[model samples]
Target: MSGIYIHVPFCLSKCYYCAFYSMPSLKRKDEYLESLRQEMVARKDYLHGMPVSTVYFGGGTPSLLTPEELKTILNLLHDHFPVEADAELTLEANPDTLSLEYLEALNAMGFNRLSIGIQSFFDDDLRYLGRRHDSRHARQCIDWARSAGFDNLSLDLIYGLPTSTADQWNRNLDLFFATGAPHLSAYALTLEPNSILTKRIAMGKAQPVEETAAVRDYGILCQRAAKEGFVHYEISNFCRPGFRSKHNSSYWFQTPYLGLGPAAHSFDGKERRWNAETLDGIRSEYEALTPENAYNEYVMLRLRTMWGLDLKYIRREMGDAFADHCERQAAPLVAQGRLSRTREFLYLTDPQMLFADGIAAALFY
Candidate 1:
């Protein structure tokens, strides 16, 4: 099954740590809508009639779009694409943009899933992260989502805040589980090079993320989520059984997907393409992956998930030399137990997955 991603590039304000392309002003929203529709029509055959199993409206703040606006986009998708009836349709939301009424409208429109950016349950953390919503609204939005009949709900939480403690991070996790959401995306607080957080730290106005504190936070997150019955399916994502994000999971397996709007990325079986990050109109750019680039990407993406990296598949798809390279490079880490090798696959062990990027790089050609 394939997927579709729509990038909404407008935001009320940028988060201190975010460097994603987003327009801070909504003055050109109508213009954006028209350009997005045109792009959709043009790319209708990009997937070549593949059954779309998931549709994600991710953004700057998709919830800011009115119910009618969302409906119009959905209508266009249904008209042009082979979107499955049971497709996992998701909208990424901000806690500040949600209300009971808004959530109810979204639910009624057949948007079956919601991913709310509730970065923290503590007001202090919210303030430090430059989030627009406070702690109360974060909890309230989840309750509203449930009350609105949303069963497939996901929440975003940021750990590794320099000002945070293990107990505080534990409390954030506790509050998240209490909400009964089926999925969670817990991310480490890495400062983007040119982001406000990075600048502040460089200017001595903010504390940097301490490695020891981050490790402790990661340990608590892994241990507690396991106890709570959440599966650490990907490096930064956890989900209960039957609730893994199908759209996101597709990217790992190299599934062809169509992405619309500015700053959106799309991938066919070989070439990956993206729209330039501009609000006026859509400008596309693409990269056709060479065999070596594709192999490196396959190694990078496959290793980040619970599925791990498979030697058999690699040997068949990328040939024996590449598979041998992978096996040889992975042997030392496997011996250290940072990675574990089963007969079929090499997996980044649970605790050692914190170094997933480094491990993947080590196996790269």
Candidate 2:
């Protein structure tokens, strides 16, 4: 089935490593919300009567919205789309922004899931990342959420910080596990171009990420999560059984989804489209995206997951000859133990996921 994603592009403060389309300024919140409402109406026909099984509010910080504003958007969604009765509605919140009352209201309004940004439980790491929340807020928010009756909670953590040692990372992981969260998404720290961290590194003001240390630390992450009974469902996601993110899984499973608001992306089964990142630059047009582009996207998304690509489905959907080309290209890597295949699917074997993008590119048409 289809899903809906709402891009709330406002943040209280810009993080050093973030490159997503977010602005710290709240000057256009009202205008942007209006535009978002209009965009939803415009794209109402995009899903073609398929029930929206999931609705996700993601962004710079979705918690930036006041409770009323958030409710208004949700109400509009329910009105416009045929939302399923048990739809998995998720809202991304910052630790410092969500109040107990606000969370109570959110639960009352039918948001069943919360994805909180609790990057690190250390003050120094918070400072390093330019995050607005402290260690205390991170700890308090989880307690607050649990008390608010939000059982389906997911948290985001980043490992491989420049100053984070193996022992320190373990402590962070220990604290994270202690929370008993059903879902977790942890990622390695990367310096992207044009981000504040990258600029500082170029100017010798900040240190570059150590590749060797990152790989070693990622190994630690895997071991700890597995010991805690969490499955490494995707490269950066861990969940206990029955707790995998249904919305995110839909994306990996190549299900149709329409994204609303600025910088959002939409994909029908065959094509894709992205809204402009800014209001002024956005043209009012929704057109069919290319099939070749869709094929590349399919490969990129599927290869990132643990399931990898299904050969039979690819052969049928992308042509048997192209499927053969993918296998031929991946043959050497499979022999090298960096990739593997069953009768139906081809996947990265542990070590290769470190260079998943490179390996996926090698096999791409």
Candidate 3:
């Protein structure tokens, strides 16, 4: 099954660590939405009648869109695409922008999933990250979403902030688990180049992230998630059974998908395309996947998930020689406890998951 992604590039305020394309003002909201609709209509045939399994509204704060604006876009999608009856439609929201009434309206408009950006539940941490929502707002938003009948809720948390301590990080996780959210996406804080946080660190105005502390926090997250019966599905994502983000899984499994709006990316199984990070409309850059590129991506993406790499499928799709080479390369790593293999799949061991990208790179053809 394929998927569709819509990027909303307007935010009330910019986070210090964010690198995604977005503006703090909604000056061009109408024009951007119109262009998004046009882009969808123009790219309707891109998926070639494949039933769209998921529709994800990601962004610079999707909750900022009014109900009418959101509904208009959803209606356009329904009219133009073959969206599945039970498609996993998701919207990324910020706690500060969501209201009980607004969330209920979103539910009525066919959004079955809500991923809220609650980076931290501590006021200090929130301020340090330059997030608009305070701890109380975050908790209230979750309670309101539950009241609004959103069962498939996901919460995003960022750990390893410069001022965060181990106890504080644990408290954050405890609070997160108490919310009863079925899905969680936790990421370690990293300063992106040219971002406010990075600039501050360079100027010695803010402390840089400590690698040891970040690693410890990641370990804590994995252990807590396992104890809580959440599957560490992706390196950075944990979910209750049957609650994985299907749209995100499509990308990892190399399924074809189309992305609309600014700074969105799409993959067509063999080629990859992405729009420029500009509100000037959907100008895109495309690349035809080479054999090496496909092989590297196949290993890289699958290795990052719990599903692991399917050796049999790889052999059939990529060739027996390539599959054999992978197994041969993995033999040593498996012995070193960095990787483990079942009868037909190979995956990174829990302790070595932090090195997944490097491990995948080492096994690249």
- The Cα local distance difference test for each model comes to 0.91, 0.86, 0.91
RMSD of 1: 1.0
> For residue 311, what is the lDDT in candidate 3?
94
Q: Is candidate 1 or candidate 3 better by TM-score?
A: 1
Pairs that clash in candidate 1: none
For residues 1-365, what per-residue lDDT tens digits would candidate 1 score against the true structure? 68999999888998888988887778888998999889988889999999999999998899989999999999999999999999999999999889999999999999999999999999888888889999988888999999999999999999999778999999899899998999999888888889999998899988887877777888899999999999999989999999999999999999999999998999989899988888766799999998789889998998899899989999999999899999999899888888889997998757677888999999998
lDDT of 3 by residue, 61-118 (tens): 8888999999999889989999999999999999989899999999998899999999
Q: Candidate 2's error at 10, in angstroms?
A: 0.7
Clashing pairs in 2: none
lDDT of 1 at 195: 94
What would the TM-score be for candidate 1 when compared with the true structure?
A: 0.98
- The TM-score, computed over Cα atoms with residue i paired to residue i, of candidate 3 is 0.97
